[model samples]
Target chain A: MPLTPNDVARLADLARIELSDEELAGLTGQLDLILESVQVVASSVPPETTPTSHALSLTNVFRPDEVRPSLPVEDVLAMAPAVEDDRFRVPRILEEAA
Target chain B: MSEPIFASAADLARDLAAGTLSSEEATRACLERIESSDGDVHAFLHVRADEALSDARAIDQRRASGEALGPLAGVPIAVKDAFCTTGSPTTCGSRMLEGWVPPYDATVVRRLKEAGLVILGKTNMDEFAMGSSTENSAFGPTRNPWDLTRIPGGSGGGSAACLAAFEAPLAVGSDTGGSIRQPASVTGTVGVKPTYGGVSRYGLVAMASSLDQPGPCARTVLDAALLHAVMAGHDPSDSTSIDAPVPDVVAAARAGDVAGMRIGVVTELSGEGYAPGVEQRFQEAVAALAAAGAEIVEVSCPHFSLALPAYYLIMPSEVSSNLARFDAMRYGLRVGDDGSHSAEQVMRLSRGAGFGAEVKRRVILGTYALSSGYYDAYYGSAQKARTLIIEDFDRAFATVDVLVSPSTPTTAFPLGERTNDPMAMYQADLCTIPSNMAGNSSASFPAGLAPEDGLPVGFQVMAPPLCDDRLYRVGAALERVLTERWGAPLLDALAGRDRLSEGGRA
Candidate 1:
């Protein structure tokens, strides 16, 4: 399916990125070209083949249930763009229960 | 001791041990060279001169006190900006984390420090390692040392450029696709991408978790092997790290013998699209190996033709998911944070502001692929294709101990030549992506300069997982033959050019 600029705008929204009108138009064309090339995989892959999400045959890895030293709280908070009382400060999420 | 700046990492280590050269002197030489030439090359994103000098002085003191040190001790090395180092900015070449200093060191960084290697600061890379050339770096493109007008292969271009420019003898690079080897190919250096799970990814900023492998970059295969040994081994911090002992690559590199080894040349990875000079150098290197008593055969892996298409889908899907953490809350650049905007608005605006064009492109592509309607067609089929590609490697490895190809189809292209054309830029990794898909070890060793452009060309060697030693054996063997044929290492020609240019300036 040919991707329209609206489709790219929707994807950008899903990705939590606000795209300008110029970027949306440019990305739509570029992504259409990229998708056109990569879409070959859909037709080429045989149905019986099992998908390999990871390279290694991995099992769940666990460690001893003991506490280990972690990074200092102050140091961690210092990296935050906005720090509150010992925690990350952020813009409010809840719209006042109207 | 014999122009410390251009000496191999192994020779510098030997000199440092023999009391003929102080770590400080060697470190200063590299710093001075970086100071003099980096204006044009722009290889380093950061150069920690004070800290590197202090670390070198400490190593010199430890040696003076008669303490034994490891082989790479006191050697100055460059780290790719993607790795986190405490007390230094770890930008990963993005404005999002422009000046964000990591709270702690990555496992690789800790290991390099523990091995007593001095850190010479972080080198530039594609922002979040998304592009084929260092042109994606938010800072600017890193110019190739051989020809300043051309690109150094990337996203490890800065690391490779530093080695080619004689700024650092050893550097670390991470490869997801061809970031390390492709850059090494164009720069006349050696780069290794150890098997997935062979090296810990604890603090190397996540790209595609399944594909990323941090390895070594150096002027010689043996030097790469030495750094590889220091960096590889199981780290409990990264659950995917291989638990088995690291391959004895150092011994294999020193052996430098390919006698009786079965080397396969993949039929699909060559011809058409490949530059004639690149093909010529690769064919010559293969012939040299055959003359060295290796049994060579042509192997067919038809699925490899689909590697690029599959990688484009799979890598972006993972990229979209992995990059979600850059939301404006915890760290990095936060935009639209005045009291008016909501949290969601802040996230959208900040991400829109922080990321560059290529990063945005990949992230959006990944989002579309992973979205509801197209998930199975794009991401699922790509995963299935990944299986087929892995099976191709398994079948090829079943018959031969290793496989060979040109590291990239062409040599260093002129800077800005492919920046506007994403497809052209993506073509750089065509020959190197299959190994990443299958999670095998692969490397690029300097074959020689291309006849037409006189830029370096890389010969790639692929080995099965945990058999990384085989890569060194093949690379060392080829390096020996090529060095003999060229009458010196390929970079000596580049160095000769630098000398002539300097003399002309005088």
Candidate 2:
């Protein structure tokens, strides 16, 4: 199914980009074209084959469990845009009771 | 003009080691070249002339102390902005990262610094390495040095243009699809995309993590090899880094013989859908290989027809996951929060403002592909196609030692022509994407110029996984033959005629 304008708007909202009307129109056209081309991939390749996620043939790379000293909390927080009480702070998700 | 700016990296290294040329002298020459040509070429996003001089002085001090030198000591090199540099802003040509500075060096940057090379600066690139041309850069489009109005290929265009313009002897570029080879082909420089996991991706800004591989860009094969030798190694920080010995690339490149090599021309990649000039040069390259004792044969990779689609599906899926970490609450830009909304709302607002249209579209497509109801139909099917693509490559390699094709369907297109038409631009990678999908090593070097528009065309050479050394060997041999035929590398041919008009001496 093709994406509706609402779908496009929701995606933009989810992506956190403020799109101007003109930009949204241009992107809508481009997205439609891209979707059309990629649809061929969905339709053509048979179902029996296993999908490839990596180009390299290697598999199952794991590291030994080991503890390493972490950087100081203050040092880590130094780069954060907003921090309070030694933790990252953000806008409240739930509304207050009336 | 001093030859230092345009001289090859190998030559610069030899002179610097012998004290015949000072590192300061070479750095100054590169700075002067950038000062003169960068206004037209727009190859660089930053020029670190002062720090380059300081680094050169350190190299001189090390030489004075009689310390054993690295192979590429004192050579000036450029890095695509996607590679994180400790002090410089590693923007990846996106506005969201306008002031973002990495706290540490990328693995490639660390290795280059250890090798004693002087960094000229970061080159321009497509935002998040998403576009085929550099026009997607928030900073501006990087121009093709051959023709100012035309594009240099992307997301490595800036590096290729720097090599062509003599701004630096070497540059580092990343390849996801044809990001490395396509630009190199159009700009008439040498580009190598090593086998996946051959180079560490520890410090690179993620763009389709599974497909992104950083490699060397230079005017000659040996210089690329020299840089590759230093850059290719295991890094514990990058889980995908291969833990095997790196082949002696310099030695392999210097072996300019393809005798007894079974060279295959990928039937699926040739002929139709290619520019006539590009096809002509590709045929000439094949003929040259045959003349040099290579047994040329036709190899069919039938499933290659589905490569682009499979690639689009898998790459965007991975891109969505990788770019998810860039929410405004983190290191970079933040927007649209008055301390009342939820964390999810803040993330949505930041990403909406931060990412470009192409990136956002892919993320949405990817999210949809991976969504609960659509996983089996879209992303899963794409994965299955990928297996077929790999099988095709493996089957073809059984008959032929290496495969050959044009690096891209066309040479550089005019800037802005395909900028708004995303799929039209995506078609540019038609010939080049399959190799990346298969995790094979590939190289692009100039084939001759196309008389139709006077643009340079490049021929691609591919070898099965871990046979990266062979790509360099065949590339160097064929490049020498072509260069000798044209009297110089293709870029120099244009420069000579271009200079004739400037001096009125032709």
Question: What TM-score against the true fold does each predicted structure earn?
Answer: 0.98, 0.95
Query: In order, what DockQ does each candidate have?
Result: 0.89, 0.61
lDDT (10s digit) by residue, model 1, range B328-377: 89999999889888899999999999999999999999998899988999
Error of 2 at B39 (Å): 1.5
Best by TM-score: 1
- For candidate 2, write residues B382-418 as lDDT tens digits: 8888888899989988888899999998888888898
Residue-level lDDT for B101 in candidate 1: 95
